[model samples]
Target chain A: MTTIDSPPPPTLRADSLQAIGVEDMGVRYDLRFTKKTTIRRSVGQILGRGSQEPFWALRHVSLRVVHGESLAVIGPNGAGKSTLLQVLAGIIRPSEGAVDVRGHVSGLLTLGAGFDRELSGRDNILLGGAFLGLEDEVTRRLLPSIIEYAELGDFIDAPIKTYSSGMRARLGFAIATSVDPDILLLDEVLATGDANFRAKSKARVIEIVRAAKAVVLVTHDMSWVTEYSNRAVLIEKGRLIMEGDPAEVVALHRQHTDEARAASAAAATAAGLDPGIAGQGRR
Target chain B: MSVTSEVPAAFRNAADDPGAARLIREGLADIVSRRRLVRYLVQADMRKRGADTILGNFWWVLDPLLQMLVYVIFVTIVVSRKTPDYPLFIFAAILPWKWFTTSVVDATSAVASQDRLIKQIQFPKLVLPVATTTAGVVGFAFGLIPLAGLMLFYADRISPFLLLVPLIAVVQYVFTLAFSILLAAGNVFFRDLGNVARHVLRLWWFLSPGLYSLAVLDEVHVVQANPILKVIANANPFAILFEAYRKVIYGAPTSPPGLPDWTSLAVLLLVSVGFLALSTVVFKRLEPSFAKVL
Candidate 1:
């Protein structure tokens, strides 16, 4: 597996990355339970207190990415990986800190994120391009290339609802990369589609990283981390646990997962339940 | 790739401390830059709304025509018809009223309905409400074709002032757009507002001079005696617009006083512009909370 050494300082990194940066960003969400009666809640809120509880989705996380850098974020579910990506994409507002993105940002948090299912693929391309802030004429000019890259052919005119899952992924990936944004945020988008499409998408992503300013990828695929990303960060329970070389971070994550599994198994055995049965229930 | 050393203004402004004026300025700038997105969204909505039906876009014109037919039948059988050219009279008011009611109602839920798009994409939040209003205008424009046919049948009633119809339509559009932006932004926080607006709009329709002309009210001595009621009756933007359409289309003289009251038109314009400015400020203030609430 390919591994990168420690990254250079921010000034030196800026020379390679262009001008992308993230500084001390944090996001918080209030967990509201509407169990109280409306009148009672209103009265309480008016009195300067309410039942809503607050929790941080991401807390005091800081990272600097420059041009040509692909930073991989790996964590277990609910580790705030997706939240961080959403915050970077400007979809979510941070509660405690600031994020400064230098240029145009394209995000693929989910397949066909803003696509209208009733619209044909051709129309969706126009709509999606517009959402990315591309003018209509520019989208028109990019149409042939998007279709060619997606490999949808005759299906491009069909409504998106009729397309297979893989086809939707291909179309989304094609349109997102077509714009060549200065900053790209991907949340497991590279893991979609069949092997052939995956290879093509990977190649396209490589081109984007080489050509564009910066990229932040959130994925559990360790192979992708080692091979593609120059830096990796492991976060757990909304806290940044470690950051450095991809291989080092992956090794730390594996050790942490094993320890957690062993501790859970021991707790189950102590309670007179088979660990295997506990694992089966989870599966 | 060569990169600029200076941070872009977008990044230099701290997210936490962006003042209200700054937010409004940035939001407006963002919307202006993404104006093509608004147009595309409007077109996509206009097409997708009725694509599955046999009538398709025919419904845009058909829906208002059917409403006008119901009012015509009611006026002919039940109500006292003081106005000549009754069908043309109802057409003038109903066409613009349909635009106002539908645009306001559709826009009320525009933000909440696009939960996925708002949560995933980073485009201006104002686009959703603005696009919905524009889509309503497209339907209203189609509804005008039949009105034009009715206008031709009453060719003698047409006036030189008919050139003012487009100006009146622009005023009404601004009025509808302001209400739409206000309601769309409010409904994000209070989902019940959408349901409330439907019933409220039904009452509002009757309050306007849509079904019956102001001439009927002018004949009532009781309506004229109450100064408060008279002022309210005149102050309504819908009444002002419908009256403007009647004056321009039917060459009808202004009621209560025969002379044209340009003050009403000026008042309507002022209210529409002032309301638009107010709603934009409110929308920008509420925008950052939308994703979390949704």
Candidate 2:
């Protein structure tokens, strides 16, 4: 089978160095007991009678990413890293401030997130590509490469539900990276697949970053952050803690983690709990 | 490669935040550009629904045929005996009613059902309900084959008015599309609305002239006494549509107060256009919060 040619270069303005800009962006979600309760509260609120607590997933944060830049976001669990990516992907609307993204944006926030389980993997590639705003002809042209990169072989014709988790990840990664997006948002997508496949996907991710106008990566892998990204930002409790060189940021993140672990261990000892148990509880 | 001096129209300008009009325009443009996505989703939905069945697309036709058979058997054996061409009559009404009811019901959950897509992807959410309605329309078109087979026995009644079937279908399609969009958008916020929709559709079924002819209802004095009920009965698009189907398909006489007048078509046209505009506004307003809610 014939392989697809390289994707055409992105059409961007010569003066446009910024691929993404965030001005004090914030996201707040209302915590509802149930759908009915939410509805009742909404009606009550409209009537000026009810008040509900809202969870602020991310607070005011400002950042700018220029073309050909790979910005790695490092943070602990629930640090609003994914929330920031989601906002940039336009999946989540900010409650305060604004996010401005130029060009065609694609994100691998969740693998096979939109796939229909009953449909064949071949069909899903088409559907997934369409979701990314690729035309049918373009997706069809890229189909052979997607299948080859996924290494599904004959299984490509089978329904996606039959594939293993790793296979699903491979397919998702292949389809998401098929196009040279102007801005790419990745949320730990490269953390899947076997060792060999991981190496292959990591190389592919590097290539995509080179081709993309800008890239935002959220990952816990410190090595990947230090090696692949030029710059990094650390977020804690929904606030931007620091932004600097990837290596420096990684070191700072490690320092913060160690301090947090030590502080928790001391607190656990004071509470008469096992220090080892406290370390596990910190997760 | 050197970047182009002319900025691509697809790019969002960071200088000015997009307002409601720009958002709506962008949403529509996104949907139009991603029409293939809509087609694929509809095909995928149709395939998934029937993937387990050996009959495949045949099931689409069989479902309504089975429904017509049950209604025919019940009406002929249990309800009444004097009604002529009962299967054909019930079927003519049932086809459009099925389209309306199924589309609305399916669309009521369209957005809510695709929680994954809503949460993970950032495309025009309008495509979800629109695609569901289109799938219903496709199924409705398939159901027509069996309707045509039944009409073969009543071939003598066929006339140029049979051409009006497509026109009638377009009217119903618009009505259903508008209604589905509203329900889908509303359900995203108030999921209880979907639960209420099931019962409302059941009540709507009886209110329409699906089982019995409008002529029979006109004979009942109680329906005529109350102005409210009279207006409600007359304003029913299903009743008007079914009556139109019978008039065109069965060559039945246009009985005064029984046959649908121009006012009925006018009402349908107005409702279709009005509801479409209303639903578009509502859907756009509710769209921004869909991901959070989902």
Candidate 3:
């Protein structure tokens, strides 16, 4: 329908996506124990305090993500979903396991990840751009587009601390998308902004992912995963329980969670009815 | 867990942990490329303190000059029985010491203060403290001009040893950088270090030869026996730098008392290099968890 004289719409070129590999990734956090100081305890422990404790946050996870693949990591809170994202982002090393990443990996752990409250919204865009590893000149050249996309007119020059959460989200989302990344990691960022802006942000992600090559989206929203992701990985207690079709994975996760909850409920009911079962509780 | 299945079949597997090596390579490159950010941050910091003031950056010069005036007046009235021009002598020593003390203290807080930036950015963690030190050095250099004028006002002859200021400043800066990194890393784990740092600075100020001459202490062998005081003073980079300042301003005949010429400078240089290296290693090691801890 377009005229010959008019220029054609831009096409997303290939060679943008690349493969990422994770092998037997494990992470452990070591915690030092501090003895509670009581007068009696301190008198007794002129000797010494107790030893520290060690806990595993992630234990022996393995997965392979190929070129142009979308993987959704879904779990309840504190299920090591964000830890896995951070490991992939190269923010932290796995205590054990190997990760091989090809090409640029960009992430949104949360919106306004690098917003300087003292700096203006305009300056934060530059700071965020630099923090994300874009060349200064490239950021300068893209400045106009970033400002426009933020849709945060007039407020751009004001200090960012003055901004509302939605405004901050707009600025963060704009700067993150300004650079085309090979591997995109999103963690609960799309839920921010107003309904109108959220629609725009989702459209932008769809537009970006068409050429994203490899993406890992960590979200609690099963519907969003089933709609957007090609495959899904269900996580529970820091282990990968299932990985396959998004619909099947989401269904499995729900069923599994429900069954565990029901089982716990049934056990509680039985314990309440039986005095013998309740008798062992104090011990 | 076999490597052959994960890596490309065409490429041969090697003994090296390529994942860690790759992280380092990319991380270093990314940090190196963000040099502009360091410049921006430094500029931002300079503006942060002085921008709205009427005097702008002249405050850097004025801030220390005013302190020197107070010290000069107090010492001339109460402490010194000297024929020497006390104001010029104190000004010479005080300027550099102030720079060293303030720079290290500021740089120590630099990394911790930028808790948000540390969480968000992937840039080199060293850049924060380095930028802090750089800002202090720049301000300190500006403060020196006023001190130079005061020296001339007293009709004291400036020595060619003045040329060594740049060289000495670098050594002092390197030492301060090392201390800042260690302190900053410590401060991240325990906020109490910040409060302790203030007390440490106070003790250092009194113990240092900044306010008084080290030459006077020779009369008291008690000072010689107290190696803790002696070591803290003589081993301090500021002590060496301030002694050199005294040498230039007062024309103190011999080199600063306790330190050996080659040995002291060499010790300082080695410590500076070692600290820089240690700070880099420690900062990088601690960096992976900074985001979470913050």
Candidate 4:
């Protein structure tokens, strides 16, 4: 029923939709101990010989998030979910392949990760806002809204160290979400807050997912994955093992976890060790 | 539901780490574009420092003033030196020396100290050292308050040449920045650089013409015997900077102040500007691995 003269919406363009793209990217860490080497010796080391081992944190993983879509990344601890988000946020350079993010990305890589505890929450908000590429005046104009979002009350003017851990996470979420970023990357940012804040933050994330050009979130919350995300990615041992509807990806993730647990239990029996004791420790 | 695997033409590819030329060009470009941000960070850093003390920013003025007094006392009574207007002479060097030392110490730890921020945020990490170095400018300006008062004590020493203080300082700032970005990047790999930097800076200050003028160095038999030693002494950036500072601030005890060796300073500026470019490239080359290491 639209007239031929009516122009196409800007959202229909591929440029707007291709908010983030990664192609077969990998990250490798030099697994050597941090040895004290002087400038000359290090230059020599860089020139050629090295006995250090390398570990790949992410390998052969291609991912993309277009506008108007939110992808949930569900993976076991140490499965490189955080690393993938960092890569998309352009914090970590990939060792192989390419990554392209189309917009100003606001990544909550670690909740309240950069706050200087000695400074006031207000000061940290300004600092965080600057780090997010917001001008000082812009951050100042947005201050009331951010403070309101955190609901820290007078505590907003207090040093961050005095605030409880939950308060810190709340402030982090508030500052991170202050800007309506084109791409939003969240890494278990809602895991720490109390039930009320978690509910509120979850609702906020849902709203952002609808508004932001693209969003990538890493979470262990199974219900959240199935209920909220347009798609889910399952990462295992530094690889994207599955990607599909949230329900199916979550199913595969659970199945893999169960199998891995069973295998560990079987190995514990072979070693004549108590599975209860061993599993209780690390896992 | 559809996701384009192709990287849009507008999207920058991270796989291609830039060459040295581009790294230097882009590094400077980033600094220019983010100059306002650098100012904000510098102010934040100064505010953080001010929050830690009773006197706070006042110390910036007082610390140098007190140090000048101590040096005056030592030189006149303890050492028995007859350097004229000793307070003005030493203060001239002390003021710039404090700026240099603090800039070095701060920049050395700038990257490693912000491990959390570097890990979490994606802004230019170079801003840390640049901001830290720039913060010294504020402290230096505050130090000048005492410099003004000290100049009043030796009223005869003040001259029109005093205005050249900023011009000489601009060269010193460039030299300090070259050292800063290099040290900041190196410190990430070698955390001990933080401690090593302080000791090296102390030795550097003494080696410079801070405590003694170049004319005094020329009087020493060892310096006079070898032309190469004289050449090396003159080659020091501080040798040029301190001499330039002395010309405008202290002047000769016998005659009025004269213009500094402009040729030397111009040469130093050019060298520093080139070194800064090289350092920026080194910094950008190491930047990608900073998040991983930190």
What would the TM-scores of all predictions be? 0.88, 0.88, 0.82, 0.90
- Candidates by DockQ, descending order: 1, 2, 4, 3
lDDT of 3 at B110: 75
Please give the lDDT score for candidate 3.
Answer: 0.70
Q: Of models 3 and 4, which has the larger DockQ?
A: 4
Candidate 2 stretches with Cα past 4 Å from truth are A1-15, A32-50, A263-283, B1-27, B253-260
Winner of 1 and 2 under lDDT: 2
- The sequence of per-residue lDDT tens digits that candidate 2 reaches over residues B1-294 is 212121232322224455656655765675687788899989998988788889988987888889999988898889765566667778878888888888898999999888887788777888889899999988888988997888787665556766677777888888888899989988877878887899999998988888887767767789767657767786787878888776666545332112335577767878887777677777887787788887
Error of 1 at A136 (Å): 3.3
Candidate 4 on A1-283: residue-level lDDT in tens? 1111121245574654687788888999874425444555565667776756688999999977777777899989999999998888778888998887876677766778888887898888877877777766788988999999998999988989899988988898888777777788988877769999988987787777667777798999888777767788999989999997888899999999999899777767755666566565544
**What would the per-residue lDDT of candidate 3 be over residues B1-294, giving only the tens digit for each residue?**
111111121111112244444544543553466677777777767866664589988988888889888987777777665636667667777777777777777876777777765644445666677777778888878977897777676653565656666766777777877787777766665556667888888888777777777766665587777856665667776677677666655555333222225557667878888777666666666766565555
Docking class of 2: acceptable
Per-prediction DockQ: 0.37, 0.35, 0.20, 0.33
TM-score of 4: 0.90
What TM-scores result for chain A when each predicted structure is judged separately against the true chain A? 0.85, 0.85, 0.82, 0.85
- Candidate closest to the true structure, highest lDDT: 4
For candidate 3, the TM-score of chain A alone versus the native chain A is: 0.82
lDDT of 3 at B99: 77
Cα-based lDDT at residue A56, candidate 3: 67
